[model samples]
Target: MKTELVQTFGSRFERSLIEEIADIGTWMEVPAGETLMDIGNYIRQIPLLISGVIKVLREDEDSDELLLYYLEQGETCSVTMSCCLGQSKSEIRAVTETDATIVMVPVQKMEEWMAKYKGWRSYILESYHHRLNELLHTVDNIAFKNLDERLMEYLKKKSEISEDNNIRNTHQEIAVDLHTSRVVVSRLLKRLEKMKKLQLHRNYIQILDL
Candidate 1:
C-alpha cells in the first residue's frame, strides 16, 4: 500500500510525507454496491482510492438520492475533507460503484497533513474545486435540462467513467440515480433506442453512438 501511494503521488510530495502516510494509512477493500458513507454521519477517516470507482450522492429529506459524481482510481473524496475540516456530520453519501481498494487516513492526520505538507494541501483544494464544479454541472442539468436529456447525460457519464459503453444497470436503477420514476426512464430509453443512440437489453444498455 505504501508503494502504491508513493507510485501514485510521490513525485508531487516529499519522501518524508509519503513515509508518514504509509505509517498512518490503513488499507481497505470495499465490494460493489456497498455504502461507504451515509448522510448525517460523522466521518472519522478519509479514503484515498487506489483502484475502482466510488459514486458520491446527495439525498433529500425523502431519501431520494441524486448522483453527484464519481471518485475513481487515485482520487479522494472531497466531502470527507469538508467533514474533517469542520468536524461536522456528512450531508452526502458515498457508495462503491465497483469493487474498490482504498487507503484510509485518520481524520486528525488529514488536518495535520494539510498544515504540514504543501502537496497534501494542494490535493485537497483541487479535490474540492473538482467536486464543486461537478455538483454545479449536476444542478445545471437538473434545473435547465429535461428528464430525457439528463438521463442521456447520466448514461454518457457512467459509460465514460466505467470506460465501457455497456452499462449493466436496470431502468429502475437508472431512475433511482436520476431521481425519477422507472416508467419515465423506460419511456426515454425506448425513445433513445428508436433514435439508434443505444440498444437496450433485458438488464443492460449498450451505447451504439452518442
Candidate 2:
C-alpha cells in the first residue's frame, strides 16, 4: 500500500505524509459508474486518486443532475474536504468515470495532518483553489454560453476525460448531465450529426469534431 502511495504521490507530498496515508488510508478499487458519494451523504473518507477519473456532480431537489467537474489522477475533491471539516453531509456527488484505484483517507486525520505537515496544508489549499476555478468555469458556461455552445463544451470535456472520441453515454444521460430535457439534447445532436460534428449510433456517439 505504501508502495502504491509513494508511486502515485511520492514527489507531490512529503515522506511522512505518504507514510501516514499508507498507514491509515483504506485502498479501494472502485469500478466505473459506481456512485462513491452522493448528495446529503455524510462523507467519512477523502479519496486520493491514483489512477482513472472521478466526475463530481451536483443535483437539485427533483433529482436533476449537472456535471460540475472531474477528479483525475493524483487529485482529491476539495468539496469533500469542506464537508469533512464542517461535519456536514456532502453537497455534491462523486462517481467513478473509469475503473479507479484510490486511497480513502479517514476524515479524522485531516486536522492533525494540517497542523502537523506544512506540505499537507499546502496541498489541501492548492486543491481548494483548483476546484474553485473549475466551479467558476462551470458557472460561466451556464451564464454566458448558449445551450448549443454549452453542449459542445460538455462534449469536448467528456471526450478529453474519457480519452475517447467514442462517447458511450446515452441521450438521456447527456440530458441529465447537461441539466436539460432529453428532447433538447436529441434535437441538438441531430443537428450536430448533419453538420458532421458527430455521428450518432444506438447508445453511443462518435465525435468527429472534438
Candidate 3:
C-alpha cells in the first residue's frame, strides 16, 4: 500500500509528505454494493481510493437519493473533505460501485496534512473543483434536460466509469437513480431499444452504438 501511494502521488507530493501518509494511513478493502458513508453520520476518516470505483449520492429529506458522481482510481471524496473540515455530519452517501481498496486517513491527519503539505492542500482544492463542476452538470441535466436525454447521459457516464459499455444494471435501479418509476424507465428503454441505440437484457444493458 505504501509503495502504491508513492507511485500514485509521488510526482505531485514531496517524499516526506508521501512517507507520512503511508505511515499514518490504514488500508481497507470494501466490497461492491457496500455503503462507505451514510447521510447524517459523522465520519472520523476519509478514504483515498486506490482501486475500483465509488458512487457518491445525495439524499433528499424524503430519503430519495440522486447519483451525484463517481470517485475512481486515485481519487478522494470531496464530500468527505468537507465533512472533515467542518466536523459536521455527512449530508451525502458514498457506496462502493465495485470491489475497492482505499487508504483511510484519520481526520486528525487530514487536518494536519492540509496545513503542513502543499500537495495535500492542492489535491483537496482540485477535488472540490472537479466534484463541484460535476454536481453542477448534474443539476443542469435535471433542471433543463428531458428524461430521455438524462437517461442517455446516465448510461454514458456509467459506461465510462465502469470502462465497459455492457452495463449490469436493472431498469428499476436506473429508474431509482433518475428518480422515476420503473414502468416509465422500462417504456423509455424499450423505445431506446427500438431505436437501436442499445440492447436491453434481463438484467443488463448492452450499448450497440452509443
Model 1: number of backbone collisions:
0
Best-to-worst order by lDDT is 2, 1, 3
| Candidate 2: Cα lDDT at 57 | 94
Q: Cα deviation of 8 in candidate 3 (Å)?
A: 2.0
Query: Could you give candidate 2's per-residue lDDT for residues 1-210 as a string of tens digits?
Result: 888888888777899899889888898999999999999999999999999999999999898899999999889999999999999999999999899999999999999999998888888999999999999999999999998888877888889988899889888988988999999999999998999999999878998996
TM-score of each: 0.96, 0.95, 0.96
lDDT for each residue of candidate 3 in 131-166, tens digit (9 for 90 to 100): 999999989999999998898888988898888999
CA deviation > 4 Å runs, candidate 3: none
Q: How well does candidate 1 score on lDDT at residue 68?
A: 89
What alpha-carbon RMSD in Å does predicted model 2 have with respect to the real structure?
A: 1.2
Lowest summed-lDDT stretch of 10 residues in model 3?
A: 5-14
Error of 1 at 173 (Å): 1.0
Q: Summing lDDT over every window of 10 consecutive residues in candidate 2, give the lowest-scoring window.
A: 4-13
Question: In terms of TM-score, how similar is model 1 to the real structure?
Answer: 0.96
Model-by-model lDDT, in order? 0.89, 0.91, 0.88
Deviation of model 2 at 48, angstroms: 0.8
